[model samples]
Target: MNSSVPYLLAILGEGVVPPSTMVCHGDDLGLLRGDGVFDATRIVTTEDGTSRIDHLEEHLSRFARSIAGIDGPTPDMDSWHRLIEDAARNWRVPGEATLKLVYTNGREVVPGPPRGFLIIAPLSETHMEEREGINVLCLSRGVTSDAFADAPWLLGGVKTLSYAVNVAALRYAKSQGADDVIFTSTEGYLLEGPTSGLVVKANDALWTTPTGTTGILSSITVNTVFEAADDNGVKTATRLMRRDEVLRAQGAWLLSSIRGVVPILSIDGHPAPHDDEMTHRLRVWAGFEE
Candidate 1:
């Protein structure tokens, strides 16, 4: 948007526009009511001025599912593909950045098609630092693990624009002198982080919470790590776990798109075991070895 904003490239539709260009208006549902869906992935730029987007197809598929969760029209995948390519082609800063896709339900004041756009920007230093390790607090989500069952309206597993609660959770954790939070169901089952997925090492296998009824947003990064682990003879599972179990587990980590894999150092002031080998392996599996 301004000169002070470091390395930003935006594409609203098939054309690239200035970072400060207005992509949405006041009446836009995404702004006024948070009726939108989005997804993001890592974009690594090499010294050769070439950028590579990881889990590109998986991000698109999940984004489509999010749009469907909101009963929105299907996005133009081809246009988005072209726009992403254009954005990546122009983003040759030779560093790690994020590629985000945003789609909203149309404007209410003046009818218009849904606003879809792509953004490429440099990653934050904080995110990079967290990749080293983190101390998280377990917070209650006020919903049972099965609260979303048979209730599509709950939008379980949907990546929506309404993230105020997530922001609040993170703020609360910061106030508590913690780096992040792991949301648990009212029944006390570990769900996920505000913006990341929880991956616990237990019984010599990699396990994460379930999605369907757990109201947990499925994590592409976790899936990528699990896939890599599978290839390397590690077992993986999807199941519900509690904070006590996480504290007693062999290891734990928060995996996400932008941040990659971040090992958990402690939870709620309770120390958890740290496995350097496991952390390094998870990072490499998640493609965030750097």
Candidate 2:
């Protein structure tokens, strides 16, 4: 591998190693067929070397749920917790890095237990810049709002490793000079961003889209912000708003573990309402700011 690529740190059995270290074999289903589940959260390390993984328990709980969705064996929670702590302990020279946990079924033909590992890597400059704000493109998801209502096998709300379509949508948006994308259902109902959750401030309340039945992944970051808003006397809700209604909301943001809370400056070339003060406050609530 080229030395200039700045590969991330990875951990499998014990110590940290460069990401070049092969973690999976050719026959591994996660590699060949993308049959697995994964979750990621940000790790903030201050100048003084103090480090904290944001909302770790929430992410782990969600990870467990995804494993269960695939009918996998009970996750060794103790091992997972120990592995995360090891990664954080060895992760020096960090500002903001992601801690991602990947769990996959055994090899396609070979017999073995499930395979998994953790990786730590610095957050990209583009993600940091987007935290200031972003312009989004709304694209049709090509599915109805009820697509996953009775479909457990559809893996609704599961964070599977299959994300080619999501990446393609974001790539298409950036090709249009937009920073990100918010996918809309076939009937014009708002869903979510490719890698982030939607939060709209309307009628004096903070609202996010539904998770189960809607096939939207539940966002721990969005939930944290809403809980904080509630504690601050701000109303919180979950609903399916039309795409047009969301664009006209009092305020809006795409929130995630790594990027925290980001304002939507414009949608499809039309500027959306943005408030610097609110963005700052929301960032603090989501632990992206001090």
Candidate 3:
């Protein structure tokens, strides 16, 4: 392992390794093939060293969904939380930090026992801030056929370890001089972002796609936003939204745990309004009152 990569901390089951340890053969296989699903959850640490797992239970539930979707082994919530807390303790990250829990199928193509792997790494600084707004580029649905419909759609909702298509989509968006991409269905309905939720202000209400209603992994950020918005007398709803409605929205965002709530500056070449009242209201409601 290269010392320059800056390894903060790592936990392998009951064992802990420093920055110079090499992974097991099975771990290499799973990671090499991208045969795993993972979730990102942020932890808030106090100056005195006290730590609270933000939305821990919700993240664990999402982990269960990913495990079940890939027919992989499931870990007990109590035990998994313990592992996460242990890793976080070792990290000693100041303030708030994002923790990523990964579960892999252990490199077996055929059906076999799957104990998988778990990892906790420091999140990049880019995701920790409240972005001014995002510029999104529209992409094709047929290419990522997994995200086509509500349920049984092309594994769009599932957080599968396979992300070849996701990388390609983001790269293509970057080539067009955009910050991110908003994927839609063949029928022209808004779906989600590469790593975030579809959050838009429209019809004088806070709206997001009903991926949760369709058996998809309901985004914790989306739920948190709704809670905050509703508390502030803002109407929030989860429903099927058309592409035209999204482009014509008053204020738009890609809400996620790490990215917080990101506003959209442009969509498919058209510039959007910046710093609207709705944007400020939604951000405050989401606890990002910054």
Candidate 4:
């Protein structure tokens, strides 16, 4: 382990410990069945050691909702706040990092209480690289835009840890020499990226896929971007968009919490139109500079 690498890991009741140490049991349902929920936010540290966590309250609220969606008890927000603060204080690295809150249903057989933890680690350079630009592969999510309308069991808006499929999609995209993936619905509507929200610029307005009926997770970053755009006198809307429309858009981006905003350079090997000026404006609006 590199001693120079700073990290903080805190179990709900256990305080902080070395990140490399073993924490969970083999029978934990989060491990055995991929039953868990998580939320991540960018944590920025100044040269003076002061740190600020982006959208902390919003992420916590969403995290609690995700837990409930997975049949887990609503977590105590106060306790989570304390744990996060403790970990943040211990993480002395002076740069950008990610703070991830994770929760899982307890052991599968001898279940008692859900397990919760916080990991504060440095942000990935790859994420930073992608912010400049990326090529995406359009893949089928095998569901229609309205699939989540009445399907509570599908856990549409939930940010569950069951991300095997999402990860696989990204892996497949990489296998095809692409940097990311934009999942399209079976009905052929542009949905979202595996770990980010799809945002398009067309007709001088910002557009994104609808959340409630499209089974896409509500993206805090996208909402923040839209709010900033609104303040800057830009129009925003939510609508069902097709691949052809996205391909012909004035600009496209994949927006997420940690990565902020990343422009799409191409889709399925075809050059997608982009506006550098708009992308720069989005970065400014998203506070990506800080």
* lDDT digits (tens) for residues 1-290 of candidate 4: 67777778899988898788776888888888889999999999988788999999999999999999999986888899999998888877888999999999999888678999989889888897888899999999999899999898999999988999999999999999999999999988989999999999999999999999789999999998899999989999999998899888899999998988899999999899899988888887778863
lDDT of 3 at 91: 59
Q: Quick one: how many clashes does candidate 4 have?
A: 0
Residues 1-290 of candidate 1: C-alpha lDDT, one tens digit per residue: 46765565565554787777778889999989999999999999999989899999999999999999999988889888888888888887788998889999989899898998878788988898887789999999999899999999999999999999999999999998899999989888989999999999999999999989878999999999989999999999998998898888999999999998888999999998787898999988888775
lDDT of each: 0.90, 0.87, 0.68, 0.91
| Worst ten in a row by lDDT for model 3 | 141-150
Model 1, total clashes: 0
TM-score of each: 0.97, 0.95, 0.84, 0.97
Which stretches of candidate 4 lie above 4 Å from their native place? 2-5
Please provide, for model 3 over 90-136, each residue's C-alpha lDDT reduced to its tens digit, 9 standing for 90 to 100.
65545666667777666454444444335544556655533767688
Which candidate should be chosen as best, given lDDT against the real structure?
4
State the lDDT of candidate 2 residue by residue for 190-269, as single tens digits: 89999999999888788999988789999999999888999999899999988678777888899999988999999888
CA RMSD per model (angstroms)? 1.2, 1.5, 3.3, 1.2
TM-score of 2: 0.95
